[model samples]
Target: MNDGPGGPGDQAAYDVVVVGAGVVGTAIARELAHHDLRIAVLDAAADVGDGTSKANTAILHTGFDATPGTLESRLVRRGYDLLEGYAAATGIPVEPLGALLVAWDDEQLAALPKLKAKAEANGYDRTRVIGADEVYRREPRLGPGALGALHVPGESIICPWTTTLAFATEAVRAGVDLRLSTRVGEVVAGDGDRPHEIRTSRGVVRARYVVNAAGLWSDELDRRFGHRGFTVTPRRGELIVFDKLARPL
Candidate 1:
């Protein structure tokens, strides 16, 4: 992974330096590794998947709730299919149990058709609206009253750790240098034709190009480059895993 003597003065410059060893950075490095270029993936963490990449609900979402006609929505849909196939080909276990958007009241139930329409607009049309009877039949112990539900049979669950590790592993095997415990402190832009200097806790790294996939710190990194376009507001997402017995409810 080229951690030894990798400082700017000691090691040669890389063609591309991707900051952050999370799934996105690793995937980018893997994709770039196919070409004839020197590349490195750096992260502050001790290991890959040590950040938000490891903290997800592990749902292979279908982007059914995403607003249609948006870039994020489109990407989500495309990425879902890509990852689904990637999981199958690479042996990443994924359970396609689908999802139920339960509606408890008349107002929510009334929104089901619009929500279904939105899903269709996003290129998913497999949703089915089931009545209270069917909802209760499927989940007999469901509390009090679930007036109706929208069944999305394509939504599935996945293993986020395995997914990130798989990407990092493939990138490393494909000749991409994986540098851990490397925290980028500052970026020194190069003059025309010169390489950018990245000051890290470990040492300085010179790269012809840099990609910031730093997750929570991405906006901070962008500001380092003198950009004020957007800001990142970190939010907390909690996922609770229930036992198989809860399946009845």
Candidate 2:
């Protein structure tokens, strides 16, 4: 990455400016770098992946439980393959330990088949419904009362930090400018033959096109662009870390 210097006044006009340097933003920047466009990635944080992307569970899902026939399901299934391959190619650490959606009650146990069918519909057919005996056999340390489980062997864990860094690094190497600690506040449309003016905490950035990957602040950015198609409601999740002794479980 170019650690030389970054600010609005230090850079030239860009063909495309991608707001937010999280995983999604950096990925978009990297992909855009493949073209002939001059791209710039802006982030409020001091570094890439400093937002919610760093705090995620880092699970490489198999889309085994996504709602079928939706864009989310299709993208997730396709992204799984793409990211898995990218992780391998970039030498990002990945542990294909798989996962088991344990069913603790009769109602949930009955839903196993439905989940398997859903996975199939999402183009993932590697799911298997296993009884309690098999569940216990596979995970003997698991608590009792698991009626059954949907075993998704494609479910894996990856390094979220490495993944985002890989994307940012590749984007920078491919001639995409990365501007960190630059928070975008407003976007002003320009007239014919003029680039849009983006006001940021640091200074102004001029770009012909702007892409929003701002995650939680995407809705706010959309509103700045004179659109209110959706709202972003932040959700919280907790991650518990255990010592190596708990690795077996």
Candidate 3:
């Protein structure tokens, strides 16, 4: 991993340059390294997974609730199996504790079957709709009148930090240049076979192809290349830590 700034004489271009060192960025870099390509990963943070990747809920979703026929649904379903196997082989901590989509009202109760059907459409057929009695039976610490719940048995929790670190470590071992604390500024288009010049805080990085995995700032980066297909709106979520004594619940 080359975490230092590039010198003036460092003019060698890369085949692919990933814009972030988060989980998605590192994963892309690691995958690209298998193709014998010259890859580089750049991040504004001092270390890998220092952004939203470390602050997520760390759930390995089954795509059970994802909208059917979407690219996200397909990728999530495929990624779940891939990540599960990778975690097993790489010693990444994972707990297959599953999840429950609880329904507290009659309207929500009526939607459980639809949700189950949606899960089935997304190629996940393990979801079962259990009544309130079964819900309380599985979770005895219930405190209200729950109608029913969609028991998604494929949902699992994982250690996001270890996962991202593993990808970055593997990519670095595979000769992918990792540049930390390098913030990309402007992107200059290249003509013909010339490499695209990416101006960063430290120096200019030339690459044949550039990938944007900047998370919240992805839209801003896309506009640099004259793309306006989508916009990113940041949403705040709260993470509550419970004592280990409440693990049973």
RMSD of each: 2.0, 2.1, 1.8
TM-score, candidate number 2:
0.94
Cα lDDT over the full model 2? 0.90
Q: Tens digits of per-residue lDDT for model 3 on 125-218?
A: 9999999999998888988898899999989999999999999999999999988888989988676678889988878889888999999999
Q: How close is every model to the real structure, measured as TM-score?
A: 0.93, 0.94, 0.93
C-alpha lDDT score of every prediction, in listed order? 0.87, 0.90, 0.91
Largest lDDT belongs to which candidate?
3
Compose the digit string of candidate 1's lDDT tens values, residues 1-249.
Answer: 364655343354889999998889988998899999998888999999898899878888898889899998999999999999999999999999888899999999999999999999999999999999988887777888799999999999999999989999988888888888889888888766889888877788889989989999999888776778689999877778899897645
Candidate 3 regions exceeding 4 Å error are 1-3, 6-10, 243-245
Lowest lDDT block of 10, candidate 1: 3-12
**lDDT ranking from best candidate downward:** 3, 2, 1
What is the C-alpha local distance difference test score of candidate 3?
A: 0.91
What is the TM-score (0 to 1) of candidate 3? 0.93
TM-score of 1: 0.93
Name the better of 1 and 3 by lDDT. 3
